[model samples]
Target: MKAWQLTGFGLDHLVLNDIPKPEPGPDEVLVRVSAVSLNYRDKLLCDGKYNPHLELPITQVADAVGEVVALGTGVTRFRPGDRVVTNYCTRWIDGQPTSKETLYSLGNTLPGALAEFLALTEDALAAAPAYLTDEEAAALPCAALTAWYALVEKGQLHAGQTVLIQGTGGVSLFGLQIAAALGATVIVTSSSDEKLARVKALGATHTINYSRTPNWENEALALTGKQGVDHILEVVGGKNLAQSIEALKPGGQISIIGILDGFDSTIALFSLIKKQAVLRGISVGPRRALEDMLRKFDELKLRPFIDSVYAFNDARAAYDRLEKGAFGKIVIRVRD
Candidate 1:
C-alpha cells in the first residue's frame, strides 16, 4: 500500500512510502479511498504550520470519499461496497460537540485520508450523497460542512436576511450557494475581480473587490441600505473580525472559520459588544450535521464547484495550488 507520510516539516518532507495496509479494528471499516480534497489546513499541515507539535509519519488530508473494502466483525452500520465519506470530526456523531468528541478530529488527532486505505470507526463515516460524485463529495467533509454548520445549524438563517461572505474559496462558495438557495442576499468579497465576477454567476447578489475597496464593510453596509448584514462567514481571522463587526447587524452572528490573517488580533471589544453580536468559532461540524447538509444538497441539486482535480501522485502539486489559492475546492483523485 502506498501512503503519503509527513515524516518531518515542509512539502519536501511529504514522502510517499510503501506502507503495510491497515486492517480494520473490531468496530471499524477499511475504505479504499477514491477521492480527496485539499484544504488550506492541509497546506499548513504540510508546512508544519497547522500544528507545530504534530507527530510525524502520519497520513495527510481529512476530506475524502471512498468505497468500503472490508468491515470489522462488529461493524453493523456498513458493509463491503458501501460508499462513504470521511467525517472531518471522526468522533462527534450528533448534537453539540463534546470536549472528547472534538478532540478526535481526522487529519490531526486521528489518521488522515491521504492514503490508499483508511481504517475508521463506522461512526466516522457518512453515507455519501447519492447525487454527488466522489470528487465532489470529498469536498464536503470540512469546507462545505463548516458553512452549513455556521448558517443552517448555528445561525438559523432564513430568507430576506443578508450574509457577507469573505473570499471565493471552498467554504465561501458553499456559503454563497447555501445562502442563495435559502433565499438570502449574499455579498461576496475577493481580492480578484475575476473571482468576484464568477461568484455573481453562482448566485451572489453583490460582489466587492476588497483590493479596490479596502473598506469592504462600508460596501456591505451600503448594499443593505445601512441596515447591516444578518450574518457573516468570517473566514479571515485576526483584525478582519473588526470589519465583519462593522458589517454585522445588531444581534447578528459571525462564524469564525479560518486563520489566514494570523492568529492574534487586538479588536475593539466595545464594537462587538455595542452591536450585541454573537461570535462563534466554527470547527467543521458533526457527522449528523454533515448528514443534514447532504440532505439539503440533495433536495436543492446543488453541485459543489470544484476548481480542479489532481492525481494522487500529484498531491504535492495540489498542495501547491491550495497555497496559491483556488476559486473552489481542489480535489485529489486518490485512485488512478
Candidate 2:
C-alpha cells in the first residue's frame, strides 16, 4: 500500500512511501478510500503550524469518503461494500464532549485519511449521503459538520433569522447553504468582488467585499436595517472578531470556528456584555450531529461545492490549493 507521510515538519518532508496496509482488527473496518478533502488544517499540519510537537511520518488529512472493503469480527453495524464517510471526532458519538472524546481525533493524535486504505473503528464512520459523490461526501466530516454544529446545534438557528457568514471557504459556503435552506437570510463577506458575486448566486441575501469596504460590519448592520444579524459564523479570528461583535444583534450568538487570521485577540468585554451576545467556540462536531446533518442535507438535496480535484499521486497539489485559499472544498481523488 502507498501512504503520504509527513516525515518531518514541512511540506518538503511530506513524501509518499510504500507501507503495509493493515487488516481490520476487532471492532474495526478496513476502508478503501475513494476521496479525501483538504482542509486549512491540512496545510497547518504540513507546515508544522498545527502542532510543532506532532509526531513525524504519519498520514495526513482527517476527512475522507470511502467504502468498507472488509470488516473485522465483532463489527456488526456495517457490511462489506457499504459507502462510508470518516468522522472527525472518533470518540464523541453524541452530546457534550469531554477530554476522552476530544483527545481521540484524527490528523492530530490518531492516524489520518491520506492513504489508499485505512483501518477505523466502526464507531468512527457514518453512512455517506447516498445522493452525494465520494468527493462531495469527503468534505462533510470537518467543513460541513462544523457549520451544522455551530448553526443548528449550538446557535439554534431557525427560519427567518439572519446569518452573517465570513469568507467563501468550505465552512462559510456550507453555512450559507444551510442557512438559506433553513429559510434564513444570509449575508456573506469576502475580499474579492468576484467571490462575493458568486455567493450572491448561491443564496446570499447581501454581499460585502471587506477589502473594498473596510467597515463591512457597518454594511452588515445596514443590511439588517440596523437590527444586526441574528447569528454569525466567525471563521476569521484575531482582531476580526471585533467586527463580528459589531455585526451581531442583541442577544445573538457568534460561533468561532477558525483562527485563519491569527490566534490572539484583544477584545472589549463590554461590547459583548452590552449586546448580551453569546460566543461559542465550535470544534467540528459529534458523530450524531454528523448523522443529523447528513439526513437534513439529503432531504434538502444539498451538494458541496468542490473548488478543485487532484489525483491521488498529486496530493501535495491539493495541499497547495488549500494554502492558496480555495473558494470551496479542495478534494484529492484517491481512485483513478
Candidate 3:
C-alpha cells in the first residue's frame, strides 16, 4: 500500500512511501478509497499550524469517499462493495459534540484517509448519496457537513428567511445551495466579481464584493431593506466579526465555522446586545447529521461544485492548490 505521510510539519517534508496494508478489526471495515477531498484544515495540518505537537508521519486528510472491499465480524450495517463516505468526527455519532469526540478527530489524533486503503470502524462511515460521484461524495464529510450543521441543524434556517454567506469556498457554496433549497434568500460575498456572478447563477439572490465595497455589511443591511438578514455564515474570524454583527437582524443567528482571517478578535459587545443575536460555534457535525445531509442531497439533487481534481501521486500538489485558495472543493483521485 502507498500512503502520503506527513513525516514532518511541512508540505515539502511529506513523503509518499510504501506501507503495510491495513485490515479491519472485529468491528471495523476495510475501505478501498476512491477519492479524497482537500480542506483548509489539511493545509493547517501539513504546515504544523493545527497542532505543533501532533505526531509525525500521519496520513493527511479526513474526508474521503470509498467502497467497502471487505467487512469485519459484527458489521451488519454495510456489505462488501457498498459505497461509503468518511466521517469527520469519528466518535460523535449523534447529538451534540463532546470533549471525547473532539479528541478523536481524523487527520489529528486518529489515522486519516490519504492512502489507497483505510481501515475504519463501521460507525465512522456513512452510505454515500447514490446520485453523486466519488469526488462529490468525498467533498461532503467536512465542508458540506459544516454548512448543514450551521444552516439546518443549529441555525434552524426557514423558508423566506435571508442568509449571508461569506466567500465562495466549499462551505459557503454548500450554504448557498442548502439555504436556497429551503427557499431562503441567499446573499454571497467574495473578493472577485467573477466568483460573485458565478454564485448568483447558483441561486444567490445578491452578491457583494467585499474588496470593492469595504462596508459590505451596510450593503447587506440595505439589501434586506434595513431589517438585516435572518442568518449569517461567519467563516472569517477576527476583526471581520464586527461587520457580521452589523449585518444581522435582531434575534438573528450567526454560525461561526472558520478562522481563516486569524484567531483573535475584539468585538463590540453592544452591537450583539442591541441585535439580540445568537452566536454558535460549529464543528463539522455528527454522523447522524451527515446521514440526514446525504438524504437531503439525494432528495434535492444537490451536487457539490468541485474546483479541481488531481491524480493520486500528485497529492502534494493538491495541498498546494488548497493553500492557494480554490473556489470550491479540490479532490484527489485515489483509484481509477
- CA lDDT of every candidate: 0.90, 0.91, 0.91
Candidate 1 vs candidate 2: the lDDT winner is 2
Q: Candidate 1 at residue 240, lDDT?
A: 91
Best by lDDT: 3
Q: Compared with the true structure, what per-residue lDDT tens digits does model 2 show for residues 81-189? A: 9999988889889979775764576777777888989999999999999999998999888999999999999989999999999999999999999999999999999
Q: Estimate each model's TM-score.
A: 0.98, 0.98, 0.98
lDDT for 206 (candidate 2): 92
| Model 1 Cα lDDT, one tens digit per residue, 1-336 | 988888888888988888889999899999999999988888877788778888778888899999999988789999899999988888788877666664676677777888999999999999998889998999888999999999999999999999999998899999999999999999999999889889999899999999999998999999999999999999898889889999999999999998888787667789889999999988888889999999899999999999999999998888888888898999999996
The best-first sequence of candidates by TM-score reads 3, 2, 1
Candidate with more favorable, higher TM-score: 1 or 3: 3
In terms of lDDT, the poorest run of 10 residues in model 3 is 96-105
- Clashing pairs for predicted structure model 2, backbone only: none
Local distance difference test, candidate 1:
0.90
True lDDT of residue 135, candidate 3: 90
lDDT of 1 at 71: 86
Q: Against the true structure, what is every candidate's RMSD?
A: 1.1, 1.0, 0.9
